[model samples]
Target: MKLLLIPDKFKGSLTSVEVSKAFIAGVKKSGIPFSSHYIKASDGGDGFMNAVAHYKACISVQVISENPLGRPIQSYYLYNQESNSAYIELANASGMELLKPEERNPMLTSTFGTGLQIKDAIEKGVKNIYIGLGGSATNDGGIGIAQALGYSFLDKSGNRLLATGASLSKINSIDDTDVFEGLKQIRFFAVNDVNNPLLGKDGAAHIYAGQKGATKEMIKELDLGLRNLDVVIFDKYSFLYAELPGSGAAGGVAYGLKSFLGASYCNGIDFILELSGVNDLLTKEKFDFLITGEGRIDEQTLHGKLIQGVLALGVRKNIPVIAICGKLDIEKKELKKRGIYDVFEIQDSTKSLDYNMQHAADLLTAKTTEYFGLLLK
Candidate 1:
């Protein structure tokens, strides 16, 4: 049997590479003769930089930057010397994973840290920057990033307002007197999978703020803040990013970058697959089955996630695709309709969430062994 394993980060547990290793261990333990190949995959989320760096043999450059709360932390970006391009994943600097559950608050968090990473890359003389926008811990409408790039938000009183979700509504004007000089010379690409606009019922605050620890009231406040910021931006820049596709990505960082830095948007999965040359590999390689997975399986998985992208490739090549996740929330019929032959959950029903998370690697190994053992019969 020949198997191709491509998995995304498990989030709070195993990374894609680790997940592949566990799967390989299980397949070996099964003692079934097989040739296995694996590729680490990401949808331009948390582990995107690592995947890209590995695929391109890029150099890793680390710099000190602030976290979402303005605390100092170290972050890194992948530098491809050949292309003079840098790949930076926002989650590295402004991710929710850096905060404890109790510490998560979108109203207070900021993307300034991510902006600093971009600044650092520019300072290194990179001509192009690709920012992976996902796993953010902020809902500031990207004002924090603008602030870091030398744009100032001022209130009606002409006093500078701190760049954060709470201050979005107080903005009376934008000041770009000291904006980064090299910005116009650099090409910026915002890579993300989300398609939500910047504001509204299906937008940033309503759809993602809850996961970032926003209360019901906070969600309403954040939504209002985004609206207010949009008004200010339009008045000053003569452009409205409120309804732009993917404007809501990374808590509106996509919108901010597009509005201020002239960033273009790209589908995260497609871009990553192409950059990693996985698209070419799919054409050259043949396998009995393709296995891809992420942290969870749900309706959202159908919407441009790593699994969906992988399954699309499988469907095109007429390959059987299987998914393994920490949990499963979608109907089997729905998965079948999408070209997934089977879906496996790593956690046992009786296990506690903490227990499941702690034993994720081992559980995955056991599950893979059991599943393939059956196939061998």
Candidate 2:
């Protein structure tokens, strides 16, 4: 039997590659003569660097940037020569991971470092850039990024604005002449997973600001700031990005890219799938079973995710596809109805969270072994 295992990062637990290893160990222990293929997968979230780094000769460059709390932090950008472009997970520089529990203030954070990464790629003579925006820790409406890219925001008094979300209220004018000075030949693609706009109730500040540690008052202020920035940006470009899908991504970094940098926005999975040649791989291989997974299997899995994307392909190929999750939440019948043929949860019935995390591979290995035993029958 030929089996293909493609899984996303298990988030806070196992990586997709590690999970594949456990599956292989299980299949081997089952005494089954099956050809297994491991394909590390990501949906433009945390494991992007790993996916790209595995198959590409990625060069890393270090840069100084600000953390969520306005403190200095060191971050790195990865450049791929095969594509003649540089890739960045914007979160690497300004992600929520850079902040402590007490320092998760969205109003004060900035996407400045993300912009610096863009500038770095430009300096490298890269005309095409791929940027993934997830795990952000800011709500600056991309003002800081604009600043990093040579765009200047001035107050009514003609003073430059501060590089924070709170400072957007003072912005009265935008000067992009210097920002646009470079060759207009560059093409940028912003990879984002969310479709929230830049403002309004379902927008960036209201829907996501609370998760970034913003209070009701702060959310209001951040929304206002983004609204004001939208107005100023529209005046200069004659375009309004406030309502563009994914414009709210990374605290409105998507809006900044569209309004100022003329960047195209695409979902992270689509971009990664194309870059990794997923379609080509599928066309070249015919498998008896397709296995896709993530850290958790729940209602959210119905949303556009790596698991769903993989299953879509499997369904088209008329192959039975199973999902292996770190934990399973929804009923199995429901998952099956959603095109998941089978679901496996890797929790030790009698283990602690820490214990499960540490021994996940072994536990998964054991479970996969038993699962393959049935397959052999």
Candidate 3:
């Protein structure tokens, strides 16, 4: 049998490459006579650079950037000199994986570091910048990035406020006079795989901030802050982005990008899959199974995430699709409706979360072996 393996990173645990290796190991142990083709998949999260590099000639440009909490860290983005373009992953700097779970507070984190990388690209005279807008740890609505680009958020007293989720409600005005002159000339694209709006129950704060370590009370506050920001942004720039699909992505960073930087949005999975020539391969061969997944499988997976994209491909090609995830929260009925035949969750619930994350590769291998071994034996 021929199989196709493509999965996102396990998030703070196995990278997609590592996941693929462990998966292959498991399948070998199952003693199922099978051949597999591995694709290092990315939906605008950790392995975005890998996808871009696969698509073009590019090199990494390392820079000293900051973490989500303003801690200095080493980061990099892919730069294509031939096209004078840059591909930056927000997760490289402002990602949840960078922090301990206890330290993941949306109200405190910032995307300033990602912005620094963008500024660097622009200063290098790069004309097009694509920013991966998934796996972010902040809910400040992209003001942190705008701050690095020389936009200022000020309160009624005209005192500049530091860009964070807590400050989103305090902004009385915005100033863009000091923004990089080349900003308007550069094309900005927010790449993600979600279609969440910027406000209300289905919006960024209400839907995503909880994962960024916000309590229910905090989520409400952040949502209110985002609403306040939406009004302030409209008052100053005459732009309304809150209601746009995907505006809520990356803690409303897409909304912020559109409001402050004039960014366009695209589906990350579609872009990467097309760029990596996976579409061509899918068309040329009919694999027995197309396997895809990520760290968590939940209701959100239906909302334009990587798995959704993979499922779409599976339906179009009449291929069976199996999903593997660290945590599985969706139902069998839901999976059936999405054209996914099965899902395997690899976590060992008896172990502490720390243990599970630490030994994720081994756990995944064991789980895969158990499932396939039992099924095929």
Q: Give the number of the best model, judged by TM-score.
A: 1
Best by lDDT: 3
Output the lDDT of residue 65, model 2: 68
Which regions of candidate 2 deviate over 4 angstroms? 154-159, 168-172, 200-202, 220-224, 298-302, 329-337, 348-352, 374-377
Q: Taking the tens digit of each residue's C-alpha lDDT, what string does model 2 give over 55-150?
A: 679988787766655667787778877778777887788788878878898878888877877787787788788778777888887777778889
Query: Candidate 1 on 244-353: residue-level lDDT in tens?
Result: 77899888888988998989998887787787776677779778888899889988788667898888878888889989999999998899987899999989879899
* TM-score per model over all chains: 0.93, 0.86, 0.92
> Model 3 compared with the native: what TM-score?
0.92
Pairs of residues at least 3 apart in sequence or in different chains that clash in candidate 3: none
Question: Which is the winner by lDDT between candidate 2 and candidate 3?
Answer: 3
The digit string of per-residue lDDT tens for model 3 on 86-142 reads 999999999998999999999999999999999888888899999988889999999
Candidate 3 at 124: error in angstroms?
Answer: 0.6
Q: Which residue runs does candidate 3 get wrong by more than 4 Å?
A: 348-355, 373-377
State the lDDT at 7 in candidate 1.
Answer: 86
Candidate 2 global Cα RMSD: 3.0
For model 3 the local lDDT of residue 189 reads: 92
